[model samples]
Target: MKKIKLSFDKFKDSTIYLNSSKSESNRLLIIKALSEKEITIKNLSKANDSVLLKNLLESENLVVWDAQDAGTSFRFLTSFLAIKKEHVVLSGTERMKQRPVKVLVDALNKIGAEILYLENEGFPPIYVKGKINQVKNKLDIPGDISSQYISSLILIAPLLEKGIEINIEEPFYSRPYVNMTLNLMNSFGIKSAVKGNKISIKNQEFSSGSYIVESDWSAASYWYSILSISDNINNLTLQGLKKKSNQGDSVISELMKSFGVNTQYKEDGIVLTKIKLDTEEIELDFRDCPDLAQTILVVAAYHKIKLKVSGVESLKIKETDRLVAMKNELKKIGCDFYEEGNYWILEKRRREIDDELSIDTYKDHRMAMAFAPLASKKSMIINDPDVVVKSYPTYWEDLKKVGFIIT
Candidate 1:
C-alpha cells in the first residue's frame, strides 16, 4: 500500500496489550547467546528488529547475516559475531550501511576481535573474521552518545577472557541505556561497575534463568500522544507496562503529564486518562531518552505548545535524519522547530493540519507511530505505515481497536 488513511474519532475507552520491549529482548538474546547453558526468555518482542536479531543468532550456516534497518541488531550482532569467532560477513539495508559501525568495530578490535569494514571505513556491511586473540582489556571511545555502541561492547564484555573496562569520554548521551545494559548483565549473574564515565564488566558465566520482557514504553508513547490530544477518549489502557522498568523510554509517563495525559500505574499495565493541560510551555532533554523525541515532538507540534528541547542532536543519525524529517513533516501541519541558542523551540502556534494531510515516515518507525495520533485531530494518510512493525508491530491494529478506521 502506498498510503493508509486513518479515519478516527472519539472513543470512551479502549485497551491494548502493548508489544514487549525490543530493547530488553534484544539485550537478553545476546546474553543468552553468550551463556554456557540455555536460558528461557519470555515475551520476546515481535518487532522486526528483535525477531531478526534472534534469527541471526540462531542460524549456524548463514554466511552473511542481513540486519536490515535494525540498528541494535546490527551493532549487537557485530560484537556477538566477533566473539563467536565465526568467519562471516555482517550486513544490513542500504541505510544501515550508512550508519556508523566503526565505534563498535574499533572497540571490539582493541579487545582482540578482528573485524573489517567491508565498505566504508566507518560504516557497516562489515566482514567479521571472528579471530580473537584477546589482546587488550581496556578501550577508550568518544562519549558523543550512542547507547547502542556502549551496550554492544558491554554485552560482549563478559565473554572476553580478560574481561573489559571502557572509559567513555565526556559529553555522553544516553546514560540510561548503558545502565540498562549493565543492569541486565547483572541480572544474568555478571557483576559490573560504573564510575564517573567508566564501566567495567568482569568475565563470568551468564547464569541460567527465565526473564520476562517489559511491555515497550517506547510503543506506549504513541497511545499517550493519542490520549493527550484526542478529546473523545475517556480511557486508554496499555497492558504489560510497568511503573518501574529497565527501559529508559519509560520516562514517557512523566513527560506526557504536561500534555494532560494522567497515567495510573497498575499491577499489570498502565491506564491513560485525559486531564486539563497545566502549562503553556515545556522543556525537555532527551539525551537519556532520544527514542521518545519523535513522539513528544509530534504531540508538542500538534498542540502548538512552546517546547524547548535539547539532547536531540543524536536524531540526525537515526533511521532517517529525524531532525530534518521532523522539520519537513511538521511544516505540513503548520508548525516549526527552529533553533534558539542551544535548544530547539516549537513555537509560533499556527497549527493548520490539512484535511488531506499525508505523513511520510522516512523509513523510520517512530516517525510513523509518533504522528499517528494526529489522525484523531483530522483523518490523515500515513505513508509507509508498515514501518511501525520495526517496533510496534500491532500499532495499526491497536489504533483500529480504539475506533480508528484504516482503509
Candidate 2:
C-alpha cells in the first residue's frame, strides 16, 4: 500500500480556493442529459467521481463502466442508464461491490427496469437492460438508507410515462441531500413537491440554462478542522462558497463555531477566523449532514473535548464503516471512542498520543482527509493517501499550499 507522511513546519495564514461541489455537479449532469437540451455548466468539480460520471455520460458504445469507489456515480448511473434503453453493466471496486444496491435495483425493477445482479443478491456488478415500458410510478422506499437511491430515481422521474411519487418511510437520514436533488431539479425547470413523507414529481420538461456549481462545503471541513485545532489564530479565506448553499454539508460553518472557528461571508466566498473556544462538551446530530461527522469527530478527539454524536447510523454503509474506522484509528492517538445505541462518544485518554501515528484510510477518502488535520498537532503517516482523489483530487496539493509537507 502507498502511504504519505505529513508534517507541518508552521501553520500559515493562507487563502484556499475549493473545487466546485461534486454533489451538485453530478446531479446537474444527470438533469442536463435527461433534458436532452444543450446547457452550459461552469465550475464543475475536478473530483474523480464527478469526472467519471461526466465521462460515462458522454461516452458512446460503452459496454461496462467501472465506477471504482464512487457510490454516488454508481447509484446515479444505475438509474440513469436504466432509462436509456441500453445493454450495459455497472461495476465498481471490491469494496464498492460490498455496498448494497438491492433496494435501488428492486425499486427500479418494479418500475419496469431490467436489472439483474451478476454476483451477490444485494450488491454491485449488475446487468442493466433498459426498460421499455413503465410498470409503476409510485415507490415506497425506506428513508434511513442511502439518499442517493432516492435522488437517482427522482432524477429520472420526469422521463417516465407518468412521473414518480416516492413515499419515504419514517426515520429519515440525509433529508438535506434529497432536498438538494429537488432544488437542483427545480433550477432546471423541473418542479417537485414534498408533503409529509411523500415527494411527487410531475412529467415535466427540463429547461436548458447555464448552471454554475458552488464550492464544495464538504471539502472545506478539513480546513475548518485545521483551524479548530491550531494553537495560533489564523485568517483563512475559501473562495467560491456561498452563505446560503443547496449542499447540506454547509452546516460545517455553524458546527465549527463551537471549536473556535468563526466564519464571515464575503463577496467571493467565506473566510475562516479562529476565535475563543467556549465549550468543553459538544454534541451533534448528523442526520442531515453525515459527511461532516468524521471531520468533527477528529477535531473533538484532538482538542480533548467530550463529544456525543447521534444520527450516524448511515455511517456503517458509506465507502467504509466510518464509525468503526474512526473508532479504530482514533485509538492510535490515545482517544476513547465507542458507540452506545445511536450515540457515539469520543474522549481523550490518559496516555500520551504516539509520536508517529500511522492511520489506515480503509479505502475511504474521508478517512484520509479527515485525519490529515492532526498533522498540524503532530506528524503522522496516512496509508493509501491517493484515496482522497475520489472526492477531493487536489487535497494533498491544497494542504501543501498551507505549509503541510507531504513525502
Instruction: Give the C-alpha miss distance for residue 292 in model 1, angstroms.
Output: 0.6
Off by over 4 Å in 2: none
lDDT of 1 by residue, 329-406 (tens): 888998878788888888745947889699999999999998889888798999989998899888898888888888
Clashing pairs in 2: none
Screening candidate 1 with a backbone cut-off below 3 angstroms (N, C-alpha, C), the clashing residue pairs are none
TM-score of each candidate structure, all chains considered together: 0.97, 0.97
C-alpha local distance difference test of each model:
0.87, 0.89
Task: Give Cα distance to truth, residue 96, candidate 1, Å.
Answer: 0.7
Q: Per-residue CA lDDT of candidate 2, range 100-126, in tens?
A: 999999999998888989999999999
